[model samples]
Target: MENELTLKRFVDIRRNLGYTQVEFAKVLDIRNTTADIERGRTKLSGKVVAELLKQFKINPLWLFGESEMQYLEPSKTSVIPKVVTVDSSDNENMVLVNAKAAAGYPQNIQDTSWYKQLPAFDLPLPEFRNATYRGFQVEGDSMLPNLKPGEWVLAKAVEDIAHVSPNKIYVIVLEDAVLVKKIEKAPNSNNVTLISLNDSYPPYRIEPQQIQEIWQVNSKITFGVDATTEKGLLRQLQESMEELKNQFNHGKS
Candidate 1:
């Protein structure tokens, strides 16, 4: 009986997504197993379940007959970026958005040729290996002593708005402007409050509809800073402190 319910629910998922059996299999990249599982000739495997969770944001408990909820929150759906550029090898390249291009980014973001014209490169870092990344030039003094003007911030696209972590900085793309700000979840509301590291700029709230894209700031690049300068030394110290905090959290977990 449990198996029957799970199989029925799985078919319902395909219908809900408006995908045929073949189409759903293509999306999950498991064409071989999809038909078998749907017909009850085989049981669903853990790997398939993981893929469904990662791709469709489907509620795992519900699929297993453990809960009544059929799906996770709609806000958890991953936002697929448009007009992404790729290298000759077909690997994704991180596109650079300098201050000049940023001004027109919001309006021309969907233009494929615009992305092609932007400078792009690939990094050998492990953390950046499996994700789409983009670089944005920092402008103004809004971020303050931590992120200086003219520095470049490399960020990965958030899988979903619901996955946005609080107290971290993000490069938020809006219809009219692009802003790099710290995020704070507004209590009991779908809107978010954008905060700044520098107290001079007051925090502001924005509705979800205003957000075009959200990229979590991962690391930064700056030139002409070495061990001899105060700014360089401060930057090193900050990196070290953050590394230590991460290590401590990992150990605790």
Candidate 2:
């Protein structure tokens, strides 16, 4: 089932955007019938959502209640970031890990030359220079909707794995593949489970010993989106709407 956009959320968005009901609807191409919904005559539709996001590059998470930030920065407005840089010691370089190299990261974690050969770019964020950061191009949908493929994610290196928090996402560097998954304590004391956001894929356990390196998922950097990105945005909206409807029904009863 897909998520839905709710009437309350619609009003919130209108107010947040500093637009009257009609004015917000105007931009969403729903100006005509928008009043109907406002007067308890109709409901917000997917078409309006499609137009809203495409026109304003609004973050679906915020619009649908998944995130508080509605307007994503231009660089990360889309599902993918064009470039990622890792801040180096002495505050000079941001390591850029391309997909090709990221696929082989586990094997090269201990290789000094390989790390140096990784591309470097300058990042202006002052906080980035404070500690080591690695940028990885997400290559799979295991962490879908929230973390999409082609998007860039930054994580700070955890010097000691003991401090890992439950249910937090982390980059697990394994020998053959590098994974971005949520961490949970496995049944086996010696192993840990790596969970995927997309429930279609089952959770699996892994021995921490197999992990060559781990980084906590910090921030996501997005570039831009296309026509197809609407599918994701709509899905998020639908899910939020479903929750809202359930709450309303529960209250009425």
Q: Which candidate should be chosen as best, given TM-score against the real structure?
A: 1
Against the true structure, candidate 1 reaches a TM-score of 0.65
Question: Model 2, range 13-71, lDDT digits (tens) per residue?
Answer: 67777887667667777755466665556754667666667777676666667776676
**Candidate 1 per-residue lDDT over residues 57-127, each given as its tens digit:** 77888899887766677564334565678888988878878787899999998898887766676554445
What's the number of clashes in each of the models?
0, 11
Off by over 4 Å in 2: 1-89, 186-188, 224-253
TM-scores vs. true structure, each candidate: 0.65, 0.51
Worst 10 residues of 2 by lDDT: 76-85
List ranges where model 1 is wrong by over 4 Å.
1-78, 224-253
**Candidate 2 Cα lDDT to native:** 0.65
CA RMSD (A), model 2 = 21.3
